[model samples]
Target: MNSETTYLTDLAAVLWPCGGLLGPGDRGMRRRVRRDRGNQYLPVPSAHNPRVILPAYNRSAATRGITSFAQGHSLRERARTLLLTGAFATGMAPLLLRDRLYVGAGPGIEHALTAALDRDLSIAIHVGPPRANRKPVLLLLTPGGRTIGYAKVAVNDLTSRLVRAETRALRHLAGTPLRDVTVPRLLYEGEWNGHPLLVQEALPVGEQTDRPTRRQLLRCVTQITAVAGVRELRLSTSPYRHSLEERIVALGARPEAAPLRAALRRLPDVRVPFGAWHGDLTRWNIASTARRAFVWDWERLCLDAPAGFDALHYDLNECVQAGVHPGVHQWLDSGSRLLRDPLMSGTGLRPHTVSTVMALYLIDLATRYLHDRQAESGGRLAAVDDWLLPALEGLQERAAHEAAGPA
Candidate 1:
């Protein structure tokens, strides 16, 4: 590729500021435009505004994979594989070892972690605000507060289940075909405070402005979702389908959740392709650098889900938080155009497939909110049932009409 040729990542720089506050730490991707020179390229200088350096993202050569390129993205892939289990785990290197000194006491936790990891620098532990359904995050930092990694623990039965699941998911992905795909590399997993603990390398993401539109983001996510297809086989029936159905029933039992429940019963049969999906593919869980989107938060990973659900989750996350209020129906209709047109163009799903996927996505969102472990924080989904259900039902009607297109 010529230095003058425009890379999709270069185009992405144009959209960074537009995707405001869309990722972890509520940080957005912002970039400065470079002047195109004939057959040549030069880095945009930071001699003017210093803030540009703070969100500084460097894009590598372009590729189809979302976060890292398989062909030339060896920087992240060459990470030293660490042993975290079985007999090989004990007395490991600093970055690979779990803190052996802190049994449970709070005072020595930082000391134990510092000694177990990096002894030379002074360290501080900061407990982050609780994430929905996950433990309060723990940030490990230098005395200057540069982050090393984030730590999570099985704080209770609920968190334990989630933490353990993510550990398994990362390990399951370690040696797989999509090994080069950008994902958090697990640093260590050991017990602390009578529960399981996991520490992972932190990867930051921010987007280039126009290179990845809301449309391109959807395409990028859908591209990565294909990893699940490569990683696992689609089952004739997934236990998760039953699990989601059961949640629908549980929520329906609550009189207030009746609309959400009723909507679930009307979904068209969807085609669920199997593979690992990030589970939570929202702006909050993904970051953008120049070349790829870094996806984190793997606890909800499911091996079986219809193709479009991850993209569906990403699109709906911010909306659900603001409540299922007015204009949501119109917004969903307008937003879904991508799925109907460019997203599924090459896949050959029938027109009815659109309606089914749409209905299922809404039902899945509602299910998540009704049970949102956030304890008083999850459901703006309750409001979604008001207009979105009817809106989804309309998809079915429209799909039927389109299937019988103008005589």
Candidate 2:
């Protein structure tokens, strides 16, 4: 027994830098593990460490991976050492989850989330940005592997202010009808290390099927954005107009861009059916269950927006990302049609003004993210340019044709 103990200590000296990959007795055991996992990481849980997900076991190899690190590491490096070594003490997968990969918080966020757990039972925290709110969300789990809530870690003073709004918005919605739609409930809100943290209800989501139809989408928009006694106004420039203008400025002045920009600037300000707008409305932020859409992510929620804008924003963003083909005209047509349909919506829009409102709104929605794409270079920018510019030209041509009065 003494010899076995001594062997572990000596092995630790040699292998600690190479991602310990073992506990005291796990050297031989880990050696017997499959060597073909490549650089994939497993989220192993450790009672000794508070953090939910730890590096399970990394096989040292010639290729650069998690195992390749310098010696004489800092406090963080040492913690990582403990995580990798202490993690696999039993030579078994993390009991918390059956899946090999853990989709929870990364280091910066996990550190805060672990400290926030403040419990004795082992907690499993995974970074599920898609599940959290669609962009870098952290989730909490029970020792028995049940998801309790999500952690909303404040990224910065400026962004954290907006992050706090999510909880507030959910709290507001808690009392509302939501028609038949559902949204996440905020369980708690607290601060850690001067950063705000939110624990949100982690509701079950259904499997992804077909995209929500126009009728289904409008139903969702109406239910989620409904507010009583709000004055109806035609919001011509849209709640997103300023943001759209900002994004356009970022794109700089190009000749082809000039026409669309001019058209946008000339858009007549008109009253719209004003109401609540889920600014981040998208398929990723919505789930369909029991013939109704379940919406999440209230970070971008606001009280001021034209009716039909929410519906158009949701569908237009979908169309932009999906690159709806055959001239990208169908995307515009469908969104406009839904916006005008009184059956699917309570928002009243003028028949003569619908096309103009829709043209400007779709233009803004489609091109809003182009500046970022252009900066990234060789991303989907080319496709956006291809689809949007031609579509814009088509709108201009069609407008002129109508003005000419059927030849």
Candidate 3:
């Protein structure tokens, strides 16, 4: 079976241990037993539809599921949401859909969810491409189609760590006052079948298709950075730098990490402002409404990092999503622009500090990729050496050339 199919099978076993998957026309079982025990789901569009597993015969649930799943910032993703919405609105969803999964026996996730929320709840599962961070993201919906919360279930070690980290990050930021950005409120966190589960309040993501403006983005970043307050520390002596070194050493001479170590060694130990960053601040992870930007995916949130890191990350990722591969030049440009922003003045980021922070960011990112085995896990950034290391090495070369004095 393909990886997706395997994942589905494994997930089914976890969610419904006593349940058996049945085809659409399986008729050997007692009608009452099937009615009371099984939950029917139609794999929308096709059997292998990787987008959503819609609860059968529930238009409201399907619509919410489609809207939530297709909230990507990419044009292709937006087109998909439109297509699926159109298909369901025209009453053609059932006709075009196939390969229904009749999970024989409930009292699994549903039981736990109902007990936790103190109400009956149904779920629409979002299935995306397989990757290092891939996990079951269930949209908890009421029988009447209201989305109550979004639950993430960690099926492996990496995801387990992420699930716990997100929970802690949410709790940490709860006490901080934020005006420009809103984060998910931690609704519940518990364990099921030995796997960590985190449920957070659903953002009022209804019909929001806008992106955050530059001013708004800067405001949000500034607020998050101020959460932990800022500190000025040299790269060589900062706790952040020490943590990175420990991580690199843990990798222990892995060929993929050699360049990362070299880059770290070459970076000047200039003192710069360090603060918190919303680690994965990207267009897709945020929803912009008129009032504020709603950002999610907080597993990577770090309390100590160079100021303006989030803005720099957002710019580079935006380029990558737009089909422009960022290199050393892009890094330098972004870092420089961030230093010029008046909002960053409090963070003490200066023009001379750009290259140091730039190198630090690259090293930080490279070590993460290697440590997470992102490439091995089928992540889009599979070849860190091809894209990331080249940038780091190039920046090293540039720094060397600049230091040696005008040719």
Candidate 4:
């Protein structure tokens, strides 16, 4: 079995120790597993069919689970969802065609789930693309097929930290007045079979529309930043910079250390506004509604981050995903300009030089990649040597050349 198969098998053992996963024609028939709803589970996107695993108990319930699981974020997402919906509608789901990845759930999951929520429900697990932050995300559905809430199971130390952080963030933001952004309500924060589990009330996400305007995006960022009031400070003395320095020091002999140190020395001390950021603000993590922008995934939320970080992150990630790798020049030129009008015009705040914020963002990002040991876990951006380090070095060279004018 491959890594994915291994992960699924291990997870199955935790969820159903007595009633384990089974393949086609496999013997040793544990009779008890067949009776306790163990036959209700299905493994998805396996050798039989590379599709999201949805609950296959009934057509209506399966359809609802599929639609909820696959939010129409892009054309590809929508197409896949439609195809799967059709498959379920016709009773031709891949699991029905073959028994390649069949799972049996014993009373363990139901007992823990019911004890946690005080209600019995069915579950559909979606393991997203393999990345450093990936974890098993569960959609809690009623017996009739309505998605009631969502749960995340942290399978490792990194994921466990993230799960706990999100819980804390939601609790902090709870009852806090957010103008146009809605955060998920924390329903339960506890452990499930030695793994940290977080259950949250699901947000009412709608179909995709045109991307939110720059004004709208910035407005949302502004509100998120104000959750903890923005502060003005020079980059040299700010807590944010201090934290980055500490991370570099902790990294010690890591290959990224020297380049990061050189880059830090390049930044000029300037006063800029610092505030909170959603940390992983991207297209996939946010949804649009007629009234407000619904954002989730608060595992990386930080209060002392630089202003304009979210806007930069949102735009930069879009560029990166489109195969347009941006270096320091793009960050200083268009990126800094992108923040000025949308973020500065009416707030009575000092205009942030896009370069300072951009440089700080780059450094902070590199620091996080190293701190989280993402490269070891196969994170796509973990190889900072290819993009981030070069950008930082370019920034350092430019700063040095500019300081020695008329050479």
Candidate 5:
């Protein structure tokens, strides 16, 4: 048996006691290994017993299948194919290859990575303080310590595609004005394992009070507008698509169906300039050391979107958190009013439109919270249930109140 086959067989033997097989059926654990020449499908021997003689399969057919699927495709597609074909196993691979997958600069600091500096460096892994998808990020930390960030893909099936798109988008931004706009610096990028890895410098954590201020938020909105005015920002692979709409649809087929469809149809009619708006712009993404507002998480940076979408997204999150706090409501109100004034002046986004969108968004957020009850019970869902959802509800109510007109 070849070394690759031997390695898989050994893994099967070790894991057989705990669980018979990794995935469905007893066709032996399969893995896809990509090399310079081509892709190879390596079948693992079953640990049941050596007495059972199964038919010998042609390795070439499997290799050809993998090669045909991977060649000329983006890294995202390649990764997806690898995972779906059972070539790339999750959780286990990271644990088994922990030594190769991670590098610890010091105690309490571990970064999942893969590198070849002279050639290309790519850091692929998911990151967060703990849980919280709001701040959950997939970062590519480069050689110079520069980092580019992307949003996490929700669907396991499309994870590969999402990663590749994020990588491509980041590389495009690296060459644009948004290159060094905010967050950590970025270096090289490529597919690693089944996810995209970007090598970048890590940013230092600062005091809580150092977060972005009101003026900084205004400035960010203005900067985004200026960028959009020059060129149309690309929103999605499919034209006129809104991620929010997708979320709403996913929440429940019936409760959100009509409204979401209507909102999507109306989205294109709205004349908001779209250019690199942060899809999820909350305080966490914006770090402040009491001097500058450093914005991160560029994966959701779409080219074309509503002018004040980021600002609204940010303020709404704050409102949800501290809506009941003294002056918090007034703060969100004033911020919303201001955001709609100066740069987004001509954009005619009505009160009803904002209210409807906010409501739909909140509902979607709540549904996600419900779906993750198990993870939450494990103490990972604290932020979402305790803070995010409440804050979002507040924003929705506030929007509805405003839409109702003068009291």
Candidate 6:
């Protein structure tokens, strides 16, 4: 054996006086000993450290010498060394094994969740397995046994404060019509493991399918616009009105930012009436059953936003993923028609104005997506410069042309 191995064996012998034969089972005994001494020992692989034979011989020697040490300080020191060495070995072993490791949350998860939901008069039940980022979801069974889906937001030490602020924003919005407007109903709320938990009504099964309908998308956009507008009345704080120019600037696109900013500056300040709105309206977040449409995942809902922002986001998302359904086009056309009509146009805002806003929004989204993709595909930003510049100019030209026409 090498000197290091010989030294380790000698130390094991000193720790384990009653040396017979060390085998696989002895590792567990060593682990127990380490734990008893307030040390942690991660599990090791079986190939290099075979589960059946090698550990037994090592443990036999370790136990022999270890029992001879009656001094508390000595035992503690020895235990600490063994634990540290074992941990190092285990860490290095993974380099050789290359197997994926899945570490589960310890037992405290159940207690934390149960305690938080105890006062709701609902029976808290575990739903799915724990997900990434320490976020585990639970289903709250009401007194009537109705299941409500609740998400446990995972906030690590780094993001705890930010998450708390976000949770406050979410709770405030939950009180408004916009809260459940596009998502499942929020029944109860609390915090667990430094993360927030929100119990909401379960969306109907199969409501979300692979394909989303056109009317559904349009209705979602309308709802989001209405709800977002409602923010103007309830609270002064708004999360929806971010400057596109500032956002693009932070993304390091000064060249593209110039023209886009100028184009935005030229557009008429057309205001469309808004109401309660879902700030994030994507196809995956919305579902529809035969009789009712349901939107879920309200983490991004905001009280105030442009009327066309939701439509723009949805259309752009669809375009990036692939082509959208024909139904979506029909829906947009219908919305355009409604906006053009004079009788229904004067409600809160002008429909024609919103349509124009939506068109411009779509163009901006398409340009950004194309630009980002071009960069990601190992091509220089300047390579796509030819195509992207014209696209932006065309977008501005089209928007100007549409805006000048009769409402």
Best by lDDT: 3
Residues 1-407, candidate 4: write the lDDT tens digits.
Answer: 66776766666676656645646523333244455445544555463332344555566666776777675767997897788788888878844534444455545665677789998687777776666777877888888777788888888888999999999999988957698998999999998878888899988875554356777788888888888888878778899888878888888898888878777877766667788899998887877655688888899989888788888888777666545455334555556566767465433233435555676788888888888878777776677887887676665555444434431
TM-score of 5: 0.47
Please give each candidate's TM-score: 0.61, 0.60, 0.91, 0.88, 0.47, 0.50
lDDT by residue (tens digit), candidate 6, 1-407:
44323322332232223232222334454465445442111123322221111111223222222221111234665675465345333544223322111112232333444565554323221111111121223344443444445444444442244334445545655554542233455555666544555556666644143334655555545655554333222111223223444555554654666665566556554444544445446665666654445666555454444454565565545543432344344445544554444432323445436544554454445344443443443332223344434544554554566657775
Clashes of each: 18, 14, 0, 1, 26, 30
| Candidate 4: pairs in clash | 38-105
User: How do the residues 313-389 of candidate 3 rate in per-residue lDDT, one tens digit apiece?
Assistant: 87777656534455444656765676568877767776566656767777887788887888877776567777877
TM-score of 2: 0.60
Cα error, residue 68 of model 6, in Å, equals 57
Worst 10 residues of 5 by lDDT: 101-110
> Residue by residue across 199-249, what tens digits does model 1's lDDT show?
787675423421234655665656566665532222225555676677777
When sorted by TM-score, best at the front, the candidate numbers are 3, 4, 1, 2, 6, 5
TM-score of 1: 0.61
Q: Write the per-residue lDDT of candidate 2 for residues 1-407, one digit (tens) a residue.
A: 24323332232222122222323223333343435221223432322222233344322210111222212135776576455443344444344323232222222333445565664222223322111121224545544434556666554453476568887888888888576676788877876445666867765553453357667777887765565324454444455557556666666765445666776665555554656778778766776754867677788787755556677667666665545563255566777677668854465554444555566555654564353243233433344556666666666554444434421
Question: Per-residue alpha-carbon lDDT of model 5 for 1-407, expressed as tens digits?
Answer: 54323333433232122211222222222231111211111222222212111111322222223332232235775665465335322223222211111111221111123322343222222221222231113333333334333223222323344445556555655565632245545554553323444444455543343456666666666665455453333223333245645655665654434543453443322223344566667776666544455665565566655556677667765654533343344544655575555544434344444543344344443444444433443333233444434555566556556656642
True-vs-predicted CA distance for residue 340, candidate 2, Å: 3.2
- In terms of TM-score, which candidate is stronger, 4 or 5? 4
lDDT of 4 at 5: 69
Give residue 157's lDDT in candidate 5 (0 to 100): 29
Off by over 4 Å in 6: 1-106, 119-148, 155-174, 177-182, 187-199, 207-212, 228-259, 323-356, 359-392
Candidate 3 Cα outliers beyond 4 Å, as residue runs: 20-36, 44-49, 72-75, 89-91, 324-332, 397-407
